[model samples]
Target: MSLEVEEARIVIRAGPRRIFGIPTYLNMLGSVKMAPARYLAGVARAEGRPLYAEDPRLRRALEAICSECAAAEAGEGRAVSRAEVVEAYYNALAPQLLSLAPSIDSIVVPCYTGALGEAVARRAEESAPGVALIAVKLGEGGCSWADAVYTAQAVDERLKSLNLGPASLAAISAALKAAEELNLYSTLVVLTDGR
Candidate 1:
């Protein structure tokens, strides 16, 4: 008998897994359960780096930015001030948020402060554009469910305007649905009456 060597090839096909009938990708960081601050701290610890919030230089810069935001809001009209604050705030936070990109799988604002929510979303976009950013609206104590729903809808609209792909949008929608089903507290309740 004669022995002959033949070339061989191996192929593997992989796709996102389905959860509750929805196809979702594997999130190394797991679900977006941690708050922004907690997530940042975790990332910093994992990387053996100090959180940006702990850096004196960044802290001072953030303070200056906050001051500037307050001045702009006070000097300008509400609408104009909002834009300025959002831009300034987002710009100030982008660096810190970006630093956590390696460890963070997603950013969830939880619909707390309207401006802050927008700023956080913008920061996430600037920091890790590919990462998921979800703004959730849940019922808050003393706040009507309708108000929360409205805020959620507004956030959804804003996120849509960001031009995120279908997957991102779907993720956000699914999160909102989960919140609604669980009757979570509304993070935007405080701002419902125009803050």
Candidate 2:
């Protein structure tokens, strides 16, 4: 399958606060940076190959239902850490982000496993220095990942006019909330997922 990622940059303004957003779910794959990993897993499954993923989330998500497919594992046979997955995602994501907004002051993103946050911060330092990354920890601080997911879903339901996915809502919510607490300007909210 041909992978094509498309994004729409929008300005979200509340009172004197404003944040730019790029929605990535509009891509042909329906998922943002997760597309490549999922695609590769699909290809392996189609070829009747055993899948291996060190990331528990990915392993569970990509587990095949049929007997022809093998389950993903974090075994001695292979080691694909979550960091590696995030790095690959960031490698593909950075160019698009840099090309779209090379001079943004800050980026607000949702931190799921912390790997994505680290990848974004590292890449921003290497390429786009001076760019601040604000990661809202989703599965930490006594809050379960499920709680964050449900909260994002609620935010999506309320902000239906924005036409964004739950992940996008999470980022946007974090950016807006951060705006209220901190002085943020020329901020870009990485809408990691879109509808």
Candidate 3:
């Protein structure tokens, strides 16, 4: 028996707000100093760089920050306002997103039902047309390793079947981070080579 393998290039895009329905805080944060310029520059520098998703130190720090934010937002019985939650999420992700943008072709978020998804989709279309913005359905309950494995497998199958190229896998690692963070149901995202 003989088997043939084909090769093509493709990119995977994913992240908070962009991929996980995390309530975008970038707009809210607004034009602060050289944020746009700085972030753009950062993205350029990161082009073709590897995703930071598997970094133990970064993951721990992100988790710790998210936990702290959740606690703060919880605020005993008061429960901070929705705006506060949005702000907290934004604060936590801005730096990373800006730094990773260049290497990321798109962000795939899981938003079963909410205006957040629509809003993000629109913004991505207008602000960064080159970058793809995808939304998908999320499973009930919490995220788990099983879900991640499933997502990875599905992606691998699609890539292999389509014979996509390395570019397709470019942002896969980063996208996985969003999947793990949001506990996505079915992973889905459309990405272009910025051509």
Candidate 4:
């Protein structure tokens, strides 16, 4: 069947997925199961590679997202100078997050920094066909709904592997709601700062 040209919309999407896109997911790199900083350090090690920088596959994916660049032109939020730092940091630590994703219906990134998110969102707008962009934010200690457990489960079936949500059932439930509100449907793509 031919792809629907309308259902999709450009989105400044920000969900919780591996640094890399599907290929990383397939390789289990996106897996939350890894030790903290494990993936981060790994990405740092391979900074200037095709997969991290601009591989053919990534170009193809970005091209696909760019194909739908008519809807939202760009993210209309405050910009953060640290975004490049975050992007550079994340890319260096977990370049996988930068991995081009599958053609998405829309994108939901944080409008606060508007740093890398805006650039990427614009790219997403151009990447998909009439895609919708979304933005979100997460505060320190725990104001961010993006880092919620519900978001975790999407990428890591192993979320259930840990006994975290049980104690905070209410919190976990709320996280799920937050995830939904953020338009974190299937394969949500997000960029966050752990620093």
Candidate 5:
């Protein structure tokens, strides 16, 4: 499958001024479980490329698939440890995020894994310096890299209001709420998932 990341529209809300939405989840191949990062890692493993997953759940899933793929290939290749797959996924994301930086004051990211937020922040420092980084934690940890961090639960009610009821994905709602809180004329909110 093609590894090229796709772009989502910049959603501008009437009252929120420059709050734009970059829905990263649009790039997801199929189900929510098949997150872009997970898909990238899976493809890498299946192709006998070096990859690693730090999250226990993701690691377990990768291990199961990787073992099967390895056997299919008669164990010809080695799987490298370390977050290579995730890092590459984030690296693929940098260009898109950077493209939005010039037009916005800050970027709000939803952190499912802290690495996700950190990787974006690290990339911003180099290519989009001065643009603020705000992170909303959907899972746990992985938010220290952000200029500020808020928990998913803390923003749930506000998210509901913004989403016009119950929000299906915590990441998208949290991102919108966090951006609204910033009170900026323009903020780029990265919606990490759709479902």
Candidate 6:
């Protein structure tokens, strides 16, 4: 399938007062910034491109879903965890990705609590046939050690199903270093949140 075509950048922004923001997924994403740019520019770049969000309803849906976080106002009277907030964001965005149906050639697991990270990977594949999915986890990031361990385990189990374009299992920084040394998956596709 021909992948979506565009140029973009995606960043996961954590508010000033919230969970410890982890850049765990950065090493992996930064690793392959060139190869995909040339070969699968459309698909890869599509992830990085800004979203047009023509549908008002979908835009509203996305905003609502992502904003529903474990982090509430000081007096919102709720105990929300980082995981809970990320999970809600993932759930909210899933439908948009589903409806957009960009011919996904690669899936980037950039940022999410462990549960949401795995969920995003699995959901991406389900939504796009013949999709390649890879994840990046920083040694010290937002999610807890327990969250990382469990998310890693779950992701390992699911990766077999995805058709990968590049294969490198290492820390984000190291993986990125190796990619710079060697040549591989060089593109950043921001699947969502480009507005």
The number of the candidate with the highest TM-score is: 2
lDDT of each: 0.35, 0.58, 0.33, 0.31, 0.55, 0.32
Give the per-residue lDDT of model 2 (tens digit) for 18-131: 678877545544555454355435555666565566555455434432222335444522455555566655675655665644757677767766655565666777787777
For candidate 3, write residues 20-101 as lDDT tens digits.
2122222322212122223222332445221221223222332233322222222222232333322332333333333344
lDDT score, residue 150, model 2? 21
lDDT, candidate 6, 95-156, per-residue tens: 44444345333333444334444545555656655444444553344433121221222223
Candidate 1 collision pairs: 138-185, 138-186, 139-185, 139-186, 140-186
Flag the better candidate by lDDT, 1 or 4. 1
Q: What is the lDDT of residue 179 in candidate 4?
A: 40
My TM-score estimates for the predictions, one after another, are 0.32, 0.66, 0.31, 0.31, 0.63, 0.33
Which candidate should be chosen as best, given lDDT against the real structure?
2
lDDT of 4 by residue, 117-158 (tens): 445543444444344443343212222322222222232333
Candidate 1 per-residue lDDT, tens place, 41-85, comes to 333345543423422322333333332221122223122234544
Candidate 1, residue 64: how far the Cα is off, in Å: 11
Model 6 lDDT vs. the true structure? 0.32
Error of 3 at 110 (Å): 3.1
What value of lDDT does candidate 1 attain over all alpha carbons? Answer: 0.35
TM-score preference between candidates 1 and 6, better one: 6
Better of 2 and 5 by TM-score: 2
**Alpha carbon RMSD to native, model 5:** 7.4
Question: Candidate 4: where are CA atoms >4 Å away?
Answer: 1-100, 110-112, 139-185, 191-195
Instruction: Summarize candidate 5's per-residue lDDT along 1-195 as a digit string, tens digits.
Output: 011122544454536455666565453242222343455555675675644444444445444545442222323435433355446446667566777787887877766666656777878888888888887766655677888776654433333333221123344455556666766566777665442
Q: How far in Å is the alpha carbon of 44 misplaced in model 4?
A: 17
